[model samples]
Target: MRFTSGTSFDGVREQLFTLGEIPGVLWTPEGAVGTRPLIVMGHGGGRHKKDPDILSRAAHFVTGGGFAVVAVDVPGHGDRPKDVELDRIATENQARVAAGAELAPLIAGFQALVAGRTVPEWRAALDAVQRNGDVGAGPVGYWGVSLGCGLGVPFVAAEPRVRAAVLGLGGALASAADAARITVPVEFLVQWDDERVPREESLALYDAFGSAEKTLHANPGPHGELPAFERDSALRFFSRHLN
Candidate 1:
């Protein structure tokens, strides 16, 4: 857990750090300390920990909800060395989808390969972050969608420290069993007209969760067009469960 740089702006402090090979970023209210809620985020496919959306949401969780938020680039993303095989397979999958091949099987196999490698990395990141006093022993939440959701299903289910989650923009083909193991509060999102994830599959993923307290929010949009307000809803969801 080596922080390479630190910066502060708008009452939120940002730190860029590396854990072994993983590149990650942490955000918290300025001068924060003691036990505070932590939100661990996973970026979507091709996105890094500090993309615009992720940075904005992390800032909100820090300044608006007064929570600590962190995100790490997972396998082949951000500053980590890319996997040639993963890239090849991803390109193949995209071409197959365009050729009218069924998306579920292709995506399922790809996500399985990625998730197997990522779950352990995420567990390590969570362990390191929580040990830092600013986030110590506090309730932890997870926010991830798309590739993040595929990988998160297993990580969150296996990690009891994650008390709540905001997951969506992915399907059940590869993660239904893990989803059933997640008993924490979850707020699952769905795009009514998602082109990448089939609607039935997304609904099925939400149904797979074992959490007694879970809510499903479906909006009309494509996979990349989630309404701006859903971001607010995610913050509120974390607030309700973590604080």
Candidate 2:
């Protein structure tokens, strides 16, 4: 990993970094000593590692909760060069949605194409960050919504290091088999009136999780209208499991 830039605010130190071709950011609590619990965050589709929502959540984890945070730009999002096929699919999917066409099959195909690449990239980011030796060793957790959750299900399922997760705002884009493989504690958020993801599919995705300790938080809102209280609840969940 190569360090690019850094800043500090309200006792949190945010650093920009690049691991090979992947561009990412790491946030550590100021004056924090030794290895602390680490939270690997994932951003929504069309958003990058530095999206305002992602930054806010990372700040909550590091500045308010004293956990280290890291987030990478997913392939074809953020700083990564666009994949022609993936871009084409995304464009077509948007057109279909605008035309009031069904989106599940198209979304499923896109997820299948991208999930394979994303899962390994997340693993690699974890490996590179651990090698840097500052984020602490207490435990690892994940927090991601929307596209983040779509890719995160399989990543967390495959990764043994993550002990807990915050996932939601995504439906059954990937296979239920992948969600069924995640055995760690999970807190899933569902927007009751989400326009993009159907309520039934979101509930079904939550039900597919293999974790014995899982909670579903459904609020009445649109896809981007997740309540602030839900984020507070998620912080508490991670604290209980990771701290």
Q: Who wins the TM-score comparison?
A: 1
Q: TM-score each candidate.
A: 0.96, 0.95
Backbone clashes in model 1, listed as residue pairs: none
Candidate 2, residues 1-243: lDDT per residue as tens digits? 899999998888889999899999999988667888899998988899999999988888887678999999988989899889888889998999899978876776687678899889888889888776677456899999888888888889999999999999888656578999999999999999998888988999999999999999999989978999887898899999998
TM-score of 1: 0.96
Error of 2 at 115 (Å): 1.5
Per-model tally of clashing residue pairs: 0, 2
Residue 212 of candidate 2: its Cα lDDT? 99
Looking at model 2, residue 145 earns an lDDT score of: 88
- Residue 76, candidate 1: alpha-carbon lDDT: 86
Model 1 poorest 10 in a row by lDDT: 103-112
